[model samples]
Target: EFLENYFLGIFTCEAILKIIALGFLLQPGAYLRNVWNLLDFTVVITGYITVFAQTGTGIDLRTLRAVRVLRPLKLVSGIPSLQVVLKSLIKAMAPLLQIGLLVLFGIVVLAIVGLEFY
Candidate 1:
């Protein structure tokens, strides 16, 4: 399944475009370099449109259980600032976890000591 998706989407498109891009690359050079990138954009847009156009020829909201998750993750790829913020949040959460564990251990130790005195 992974191989099928890879060949269909990226690898196949890249292989074919590399052949065409070769001509432009050798002559007009990197200024005309953006053609390959545009081909990539075209392939991706066509793929997504084709997926939704399948079956009933329109996107079925009932079958899109994962759209909400997909939308945010896809958008996050374009946001370096958001990625940095998320990284900071994960790091900040580490001390909270350690403090929670230590507080829990302290409560257990105190409970044991109080019980001994009683």
Candidate 2:
């Protein structure tokens, strides 16, 4: 628990500094404008919520703990190459989805023909 809180504090400090350096949401390149920063902010906020909920709020926000798992993804923002790869993957999603649909349709048609023959 000590290590969890320690890391949480570090992440919180990082978020605060970034928010101060680059505006929150109104500016052109605000902290929340970047997808990775937005994700970090979410994980930090959820971490706090889970901690506070457990301490005394009794709010039962256990589900929020799952958001912490995304914390490692914040590394993508630190590495330029990784960011490039991730951006390309995201861009490719639409075409991939179309191809997947085409394959599924072909399989379904084959299944129908096989059933009729049987």
Candidate 3:
């Protein structure tokens, strides 16, 4: 509990600083434009809710603790090369899905042929 709260406090402070640096009220602002900041903001809010929900209310927020794993994704967003690769992957999703389905179909056909031979 102590370690969790300690990390939460640090994340909260970091979120506050980011909000300050990005300006809270700007439309389509620097902060909103950057995916990393958005991810950081989301993780920080989730962490806060998990901490407070556990302490202030009777409801268990154990499921929300899993959201902390997303914090590491913020590092990916920070890297320009990784961002480009991620964008490329998203763009290639349709082709990838088609290839995957084709491969699955081939495996099913092979299995059927082997079964018949036996």
Candidate 4:
């Protein structure tokens, strides 16, 4: 818990510095145009909500903890190759789903054929 809190603090401070450097509301366009900025904002907000909800409401927010796991994705935004790969995966998801269904249908047909042979 202590390590997690430490890293969260680091990320929170980093996000704050980024917002300040970006001039915050003064240049919203510069800040929002990059997908990485969006990710940073999301992770920071989720972190704050997790901390506040845990302390203020006296309730465990497990879901917010899960959201915090997205911190590693920050690294993804730093790498050009990873960004291309991530984009490709996102763009391919629909076709991949269709391929998966086709494979499943083939498996079912093979199973039926085997049963008949038995």
**Highest TM-score, which number?**
2
Model 2 stretches with alpha carbons more than 4 Å out: 1-3, 26-28
Residue range 3-116, candidate 2, lDDT tens digits: 889989999999999999999999999999998999989988888888888998768875787787787787787889998998899999999999999999999999999999
Reference-based lDDT, residue 16, model 2: 97
lDDT of 3 by residue, 11-32 (tens): 7787678678877647557665
Residue-wise C-alpha lDDT for candidate 1, range 13-46, written one tens digit per residue: 6545754766534555531365434444444555
The model with the greater TM-score, 2 or 3, is 2
Q: For candidate 2, what is the TM-score? A: 0.81
Q: Which stretches of candidate 1 lie over 4 Å from their true place?
A: 1-74
RMSD of 4: 2.4
Task: Choose 1 or 4, whichever is better by lDDT.
Answer: 4
Candidate 1 vs 2: which has more lDDT: 2
| Candidate 2 clash pair list | none
* lDDT agreement of model 2 with the native: 0.90
List the candidates ranked by lDDT, beginning with the highest: 2, 4, 3, 1
Q: In model 3, which runs have C-alpha deviations exceeding 4 angstroms?
A: 25-28, 85-95
Task: Give the TM-score (vs. native) of candidate 3.
Answer: 0.75
RMSD in angstroms, candidate 3? 2.6
| Model 3 whole-model lDDT (C-alpha atoms) | 0.81
